[model samples]
Target chain A: MRAEALLLFFSFSIGIVTGDWNILSYTTKKRDHHQHHAGISLKNYCESWRINVELNNIRGFDVVPGECVGYIGKYMTSTQYKVDVQRAAEQTTLFLTNNFRLGADGKDAWIFDIDDTLLSTVPYFKKHQHGAVLGCRGATTNSTSMEQWMEERSAPAVEHMLDLYHEIRARGLKIFLISSRREHLRDATIDNLVKVGYLGWTDLILRCAEDCYHAVANYKTEKRRKLIEQGYHLWGIMGDQWCSLVGHPSANRTFKLPNPMKKAL
Target chain B: MRAEALLLFFSFSIGIVTGDWNILSYTTKKRDHHQHHAGISLKNYCESWRINVELNNIRGFDVVPGECVGYIGKYMTSTQYKVDVQRAAEQTTLFLTNNFRLGADGKDAWIFDIDDTLLSTVPYFKKHQHGAVLGCRGATTNSTSMEQWMEERSAPAVEHMLDLYHEIRARGLKIFLISSRREHLRDATIDNLVKVGYLGWTDLILRCAEDCYHAVANYKTEKRRKLIEQGYHLWGIMGDQWCSLVGHPSANRTFKLPNPMKKAL
Candidate 1:
């Protein structure tokens, strides 16, 4: 860190944010403990920054560009989430490696939920009520806020799922991004995925206008049924919410990514 | 709140444990985020205190008495763990309330792991390396140490699990305490349970000498099978480790309590 940035960081956290916020920068001097193998990640860095920002109601991170605004949505995931995600992913990979036979027809597929699964809305949620649902009537003064935020095209690929997506594709399996998002927002959603490094998905399926009134689980289960009827085998399904994974014709295996930010919609 | 205690805390964290250990005490001024609602629990209190204790490598908590040595073990569950555990329990309670038929046979049973499920080992593990397995060898020097601690019978009932246990038993069902601890410690273990307000357990099953050589899962699985064969309906099994919950004749449902402290031996 440059001297100026260091001084400003101290100023932002101690003087601007809260004097107690500097405690996060605290570490042990006992150099000999078992080192945490994964060093601090950009996601973790943003999470800490987001916590302080919310606590202080600060507009943005100090000394960083506005582009980093979207990064704060990677909030809520702390060190424990990182461990649990890795464990679940590894188990999925192992289960597939051991049990899922490659299809001779190349029709085997995996389903992934978009928000909080493949991408995050944490940055936007941090600016609003962190756990409030962004439904049509859920927000105040700006119902279009959700649409505007979506247009920012900045929901970053969730770290573990992004890696899992690549590995599934590498294994010559089909991957699909099925979301609860409205179909009209498809273009921006696609652009955001592309910008955020999500690619090679066999397809991106969004909810049609008629499906807006259904429960999220009902809409998602219907989508899963359609995929199966179309002759695609959902060898595995992964989502941060149960709405995406449960109900009839469930995948051969299902992985739930943790999202405790709110009551499930 | 004395200046002397504050100075001692900083010394223990920075000068004794880690030059950077103060990070664990970091909190925000907003004072009101989503208030974590199970309220201030003994384990929760110990966990926050333990984070600072380990980071600073300080043995005693400042402004708190010294004999709370065992309290150091409430170790490293993060904010996420609290959220996840509450969600799962709520889901379980909801599911049971909605679905399970009331059996007049009174033969239905619930299985609970003793440590970290019914009772917390957080206070013990907080002082030791969180992940260091408490193997027989690890216990000998600590063996007398373990015996001493058990005699203190200080292991408090885990807040959430105790609630669930009471609820299950209140419904005219059965609750069993199954643990990986040795048969020799049964007396103290029972004392701890009674003192901590745990009662009406159908049985407290501890590992005998013959079970010592088996993997924990194998031992637990075998015990579960015996219960099944003996005609008890294992409606639900709750545990902190997979070893206790997984493998054969699975319960109608399983509940996993989070314990990131160590890989179970």
Candidate 2:
């Protein structure tokens, strides 16, 4: 009896040790899988959706590659709606390039807003359930850490517009990218621009903490003023939001218009 | 008498051939000397001015380190001026870091204009002025032959700014480069930026043929709008021309002002 009891005790101890070791190994595998998934999933999604994918040999506008964060979420649910959005992007590039006589003499410029204009961050908001995904929350003002939430987020770029950008470049005009992303996201933003084939500006402007504005419209107006002062004549302006195009005198011209949707804003 | 005449003619013919050979060698030497002088004269003058000499490092915002171009003529008026520019650049970096709250976490962004803003193009322009200078005025408007002219042109950057750019980057806030240059200059521009310490942008906007505006202000405004759309609250913006600051609501903000001398319209 004594011998049997001793044997049983040893067996139990060995079982416990093995169990623990298995758990540890499982946890490590799980963590690594999560990391790989984050990177691959985002890239895969972008590729599949053809968002930011280059068409033909033309490269999009990007100052830096692989640094900017992109958040993908449903902007509209219906397939018909997506088609509409894509069409709007196509029309916008077309109207701006053709009607405005852009690219003549290489002095024309097109300005674009980043957030909803290029990609949507609504998915991040949905996933994290964080109100105002990119914005500061309550007492936690100016938190750059929020950008980390963008790691697994990305959406497809509007189709057919990359070719339009190429067409514009072929004509000798310029595309200017403007973003309100904090200085921290500069690298990521640039990466996305290049990836998307919108890379064609002589410069890029990002919002810093000091650029506090009463409203988004005011911020856009101020930006327009600066470009005019530099001797670039505005030919086209594009944005998902009205505030991006509002308040600038040039916006009144035919070249400036909201993303064409059947229901105008 | 006939034999004497034939001998004299033969001697005369040989002398003519030898004389032609000497003339050919002399012309080749003269051309080489002119080329050598063009390259060395710039170096010597820059050295005399106490300017930091770097030839290959002239990729981005840095000054090209030679006197072959009119840059040394236009800006390097004297050693005192060179020293003053260097000192001013150092002061600018200091001011940006300490007073402007620059850095990744800071609220200001220094937007640098590539051509004429940070780098001098006078040399490139002058070198391309050859045929035109020789009263071949029609060559200026002829596009087919412009490539030949461009082949001879060499634009050098401002070296001090290149150093300052790197220094500022080390300090942390983003450096947004805005230029009116064409897309073909991208590689050269990026090379220049890297050589001078501008690694890459969080965002880089370039002017392309597709944009609608001909004014820099229009391009700037678009950039500002995008920044706002990205949700970065900007603190400060900087550029060589006033138009670069346009559309930025913070233009009048105390921190947004460029150097007093640079603020001229």
Candidate 3:
């Protein structure tokens, strides 16, 4: 393995010093097609964009790039998406198996974000051009549309999250479902979560009318702060959005599910 | 655009429900050529692994997956890698251009992680099988070997980071480079930074001998805590490793550079 790796490294470095590397030929040939702006194929471009979004490098974009709409649509519905989310879930399970030492004091807790983490609203996003036309948190004008969709309570459990949720619960951790959904949507949220096999979570916290003005990160951060103040040791926070997982007084660990449909703040 | 996206979404959903979609044909064909595990192409698997690493989903990994060495070798040397980093740098530049109100006080500062964020240590890793063998932080018995390489001071500036560094400097924000390299290597580290077109910074902080026992995250977080205590308002922190960016008292914003070479804890 070392020999093979060293050979490739030398070839690459030599190619860099001299501009005659055939390894670059593949990308160059694809660039000539000109279907995309950069010579990168749609697959490579969208994948890189998704990585950037996941890394929290790309932020505050209201909509998905128009050029990547189809790519994102296909990716969200692809086997690769299922594999990615499952892998993240697997990592969480592995961490629990290997690292976490649960306290018997009953103060141990785990936080799970609702949208695109517990329940997937991809069906809604599918109609909205996969976050090209409208996203869940971007425009207040779309709030009515988003709430109506939530009220339908038909959103499916994200691919592997239900299993992971059950695993966390089985381990005797208190589960908190903190969401950016408004307080008025409480009934619909519970109904959807229950219908999708998420039962008996400790609390389902949502945004009150007063909490609506705060950014999702700040609201969630405040909720976590209150939880920590209540003497709960947050073992982990799981979410599809960076805003859900980042801020002061962060949990001991965080599990980020894959989401190309939307970036929530 | 919406029509195109809708067509793809419908096709994918229909395929998911009925189990017949031509879009899967491309991936299926690629999967047949399995020189790797999971029936997934080396490119796809390595890319996903790299994304998981960047997202902090994959943790405590000591080396690159053996099967992925070739794929990672090619990717690190590929135009795609350069484009990915350049795109991140563009986002930072765009952020500074639009938002970010700088204070007249020099206390408004930006923090940069030294290793892959500013200097490309790829040359050293290139000889180390691109981290299939010795990673910077994972194996400290490698200190002598790593220090000797650092002392050579021949490492190049990571593409685009030098420009971003200069941009932040021109904006008059005090810059701090907080690195995980031990204090013994400070002279070598400074030499490499200077030799690679990096000049002038508010401070170059390194881990002291007593600090070597602390994990990289804790050590850097402590450094950041001191900076914050000293009244330096951290405007942003940029790094390739999550350890350099995440934790309490984090900067107001963060920029994550793409680094598949190594994941430092």
Candidate 4:
């Protein structure tokens, strides 16, 4: 591996991910991207993604990934995934319309994060319950299956997000889809989004090889910050991770979709 | 101090001032911001800022205020301060007019660093030969004096940067003056800049108390990124130090005025 990549990856060996020298804190290992819920079982864990599978129709398990959190209780299949996202989207749309002023040009846009926010990765996760750590951070794992799954271009769309996608486009705002997926996945990713009926997007951005070692938040913020610099008003940003929501050039507002499937702290 | 502030200060003590996290490898301690030339005697090393008193039409003995470096050669009269900066400004003007396209609305801007770039603190550094290693990094040493100097706002212009500032503005682009100076000094900084004949800036940003501990590069870059997000195209950024030029949302090109005044390795 390249020296920079080595530094980026192994730097985590230092306990203080907050170590200023290692670059931004890649410090939080298992916690970097997703959260591990209490009772997450293999099927229940979403890894680093947000999944919305209706467990026995109690809505969805609203469960955690990897370890077993528990049997679905009255915990509101009312799942955080199901409840909050829809509300955030509705409120954001209303707020933007009531307050923002866009130029007559139809170029105003909203950004969407691909994996959990737009497409559901549940189907793939079901087929391979191996995305999580085997036991400790020392598991010997192979990603052949996951690569095949990504290459298959077959993830389905989240119903509500699809509705919001169309709603924002109909209002004459452009959509910019940015994903942390490697640049090589560009074709498959585009195919999947199109096959699932996503349209009118101004751009679909996949991470370049150089970005493989970057923190997810740094990578996303840099891109969004660039887009903002280039004269686009990022009306809103929709993502399943907090990393997506917290940085500068903040969207006029943001909507977070629950991706309990992924691990986040 | 706030916990975050302490973290910021302590982090700097790490040799990683060149810490990749900051993107700007703060290689030099006393050298981080400016460089003092060879043969700079204790009396000669007027460290904190650049003082061009013109001792030998070749400029006087330019010395250090912080740590020790080497001696001066034909360096003074050969002061890069006098030659390179002027040439850089002329060349930059040529580059911008030939390559960039400005929006009719006049939102394009060039960011300028206040100290050493727009105004020289040579006046203040002359009195405080005590600006460097006072003992503990805990409390600031000469800030009362530094703050007083700031309040006085008598630092003179770097001359060439000022010319470039007006040139860019005349081309229909706005000017942005951003400094790593503390937030409390905002009024004095502005008053000083104006007192010294610097004007027409769209915004004058000073470091907030909260950001005093941030690495100089990170602080400046974040602000530039925000400006881009707000739809302003940063056409150029000129500062005496590399820290100012190396981050994201790069200006079309940057011009570095020679300020070999502070002590560097």
Candidate with top lDDT is 3
Candidate 4 segments exceeding 4 Å error: A1-65, A69-80, A130-143, B1-265
Residue B130 lDDT in candidate 1 = 45
**lDDT by residue for model 3 (A86-176), tens:** 6687779988898777898898999998888899887887777776322234336556777889899999988668878988998989999
Candidate 4 TM-score to native: 0.37
Identify the CAPRI category of the predicted complex in candidate 3: incorrect
Give the CAPRI rating of model 2. Answer: incorrect
- Candidate 2 Cα deviation (angstroms), residue B127: 72
Q: For each candidate, give the interface RMSD after superposing the true interface residues on Cα.
A: 18.5, 32.4, 11.6, 28.4
Instruction: For candidate 3, write residues B139-246 as lDDT tens digits.
Output: 355557767887888888777678789888889889999887778788888888988778889999988688777777888789999999998998889998887887
* Cα-based lDDT at residue B152, candidate 1: 76
True contacts kept of each: 0.08, 0.00, 0.29, 0.04
Q: If the candidates were sorted by their TM-score against the true structure, best first, what order would they fall in? A: 3, 1, 4, 2
Q: Ten-residue segment with the worst summed lDDT in candidate 1 chain B?
A: B53-62
Write candidate 1's Cα lDDT for B1-265 as tens digits.
Answer: 3323423442343223322222344232222331321122233234333322211111211122232223322223332233334435554676578657767777888888887777776566654534334431123344465556666789876645656677788787788887878888999999999887789999998887888777667778888899988888888888766556656767877666555443433
Q: Which run of 10 residues does model 4 chain B get worst, by summed lDDT? A: B51-60
Pairwise DockQ winner, candidates 1 and 3: 3
Q: What lDDT would candidate 1 get against the real structure?
A: 0.57
